[model samples]
Target: MTAPSEPTDASAPSPGSPNGPGTLAWRNAVFAVFFISGLGLASWVARIPAVRDSLRLDTALVGVLIFGLSAGSVLGLVVAVRLLARFGAPRAMTISVATSSIGLVVVGAGATLLESAPVVFAGLAAVGLGMGSLDVMMNVEGAAAERAIRKTLMPLMHACFSLGTVVGALLGAAASALSVSVFWHLTAIAVLVFLIAVVAVRSIPELENTAETSAPGEPASTWRSRLRASLSVWADPGVLLIGAIVLGMTFAEGSANDWIALASVDGHGFSNTAGAIVFGVFVAAMTVGRVIGGPVIDRFGRVPVLRACAVIGVLGLLLFILAPNDFALYAGTVLWGVGASLGFPVGMSAAADDTRNSAARVSAVAMIGYFAFLVGPPVLGLLGQNWGILNALYLIVALMALAGLAAPAARERHRR
Candidate 1:
């Protein structure tokens, strides 16, 4: 099959045109959103050990606690479409980001004051809810920006997320070493991220026209209509196939986020600070891969690039799992990062190929993709508790293989 056609500039106003400035602003704003989202989430991930220690939790309990985040995220996805419709991307993102920051502070407080697992779980659920909503809004904005600029940028935007995670992880490592309290560390980061989000969201352009809307004479959509509209996307084989591809890939990515640090600590006997640093390395590798992978995808097409990444990821996981020493572990982390890089962004792009149904389709695809997050941690936790954290990663290898099989779904359909 032929590669998808490059987007035409004809449909996009030039920088010299009146709409140009606003478009550029939105692009930058979306980038900031992606960055802060990654930062906030990573900040929480990086401090998992502290939280676990504070609660005196075992792997099984930790997994259950982590479930709260995913549960809240799923809840957010349920309402994100309506929220976007009512508030628009900028306002929605601002509210979501601020709320997520508050949740982070709460998490820190729970750890510091109460050392209560339930309280922490509740806070994390709040974080997840905000993050899930913010995630959809930012992607919607990213899709708009890509069309406006008439270029491929989704991967680069995701790279900004990885970069943010890198920064957050490094900060987390420092905080851990210095015996910085989780309460203070997370609280400070939350405040800073909230301030930045408030300023950045101002630049996001309106998204009322891009996604499908009600017919001219139709009454405003009811909750029933919106629910039906969302559920209907699952009936489309193409959209479902795209969702499947993303599901496996996101499992690979999210598994690393939730487990890699713990793996390094438990399996490799690394200190908590060292483990966080290793996670930072992983995020940094992912950032590099995404930065360079966009052009490769554009040139090679999505199918081949995705399949190749899956193969590489599998090898990385194996090496990390079976290797005898730190060298092999580090190498595996790099390969795994590269391998895990493309699937989610490419899947999002595929889902949004038709601008008319982009919002609904993207939401459907996100729900499937995020299912990995919801189910993966607890499953891996069980596996880790039964066998070992390192052994549990074999599951990711299997998932990556599944992702490769579904990569073809990401192939862009040639427009007639």
Candidate 2:
């Protein structure tokens, strides 16, 4: 069955909806896949220190290695639409998860057994490719499911991702504490991800006429055509504004991921353990925000919630950057996490609101948001080198303000 051609009644999805009688199961399946995706990525990340030590790599080499992952992700996004065109949603999703899981295994083996940088780089690239494609596919599926049921579920779906990250990170820490090798640690994660992928793909509803990339009585669309369509979305003012929100909010979230601990240690005169705790607080707050954001949005509507989040996020950031006391610092961390929580998910949901071009729009917004991971790190690294890490964060404040101004763009656009 295809997705809903128009919005269903608010009470329940119509029997003809893609959800059908299995809506609950499908929603849970989507949740499972999102959780596994997060778990898979974090499991690899959590063992990065081990990979570095095993390979005897320096910081510069590590940076180059990560660049491989980022480059691969860009390549994956470039091909995502084509993948969907060729395989349809179910098979395409399987391919994506299989690619990422296999790459993860290769990463573990290369790091621990082969002790080879080139091999690990190849693995990381594979992981990135599979995951990048998987992200688009999953989000499309998620947006479809949420819309069918007339619910705001993206935040909770993202919350599952956050929960996965927490689980993976904690497991990795446990492995490290117990002297588990990178090979074993990541191999286990990869195997589980593969198993989950196998089960999850069976549940995603196939799109026959939905997503509007294919028209009836037409031959199959080519990758080139999909690529053109994806590129064309860049011209859409609404999509672009949503992308701006993703850009800013994603940068806020990414900045904390990369630097919160360092800032706490260097900028705030905290011990390494204390710095780690601060970073944990930020992550916890983010998870909390996502867990609660759906219900909050349901009550307040997207624009008001988004605007409030932007304001809270900026305030939290300011406190983290300029506050004079511990209370302000803790408050800022929580506020920052909560504030940054909904932007990416909400933008994605907004982009998919007009489902005729849902896949293309999602791909466009995702790539734009993904830019944060690619560029934010290096840019902030340079700025922090000269200006101090805490000072470098003010750039996020500006971006967050931009997101606030653009909140109206995410106001639900009824399907045309």
Off by over 4 Å in 2: 1-21, 49-62, 113-117, 144-152, 205-239, 258-280, 318-332, 352-363, 384-391, 411-416
User: What range of 10 consecutive residues in model 1 has the weakest lDDT sum?
Assistant: 1-10
Error of 1 at 261 (Å): 0.4
Residue range 1-416, candidate 1, lDDT tens digits: 00011221123233333347777777788788889888998999899988888888888888998899888887876666677778777777788888899899999999988899888999999999998877767766676678778766777788888899999999999999999999999999999899999999887666554333442223465667757766878899889888877877788888889989988988889888988988898888889888998789879898999999999999999988887888998999989988988888788788878665555677688777878889999999999999988989998998899889988888877722
- Evaluate model 2: give its lDDT: 0.75
The TM-score values for the models, in the order shown, are 0.89, 0.77
Worst 10 residues of 2 by lDDT: 1-10
After superposition, the stretches of candidate 1 with alpha carbons farther than 4 Å from their true spots are 1-21, 205-238, 354-361
Residue 327 in candidate 1, Cα distance off native in Å: 1.3
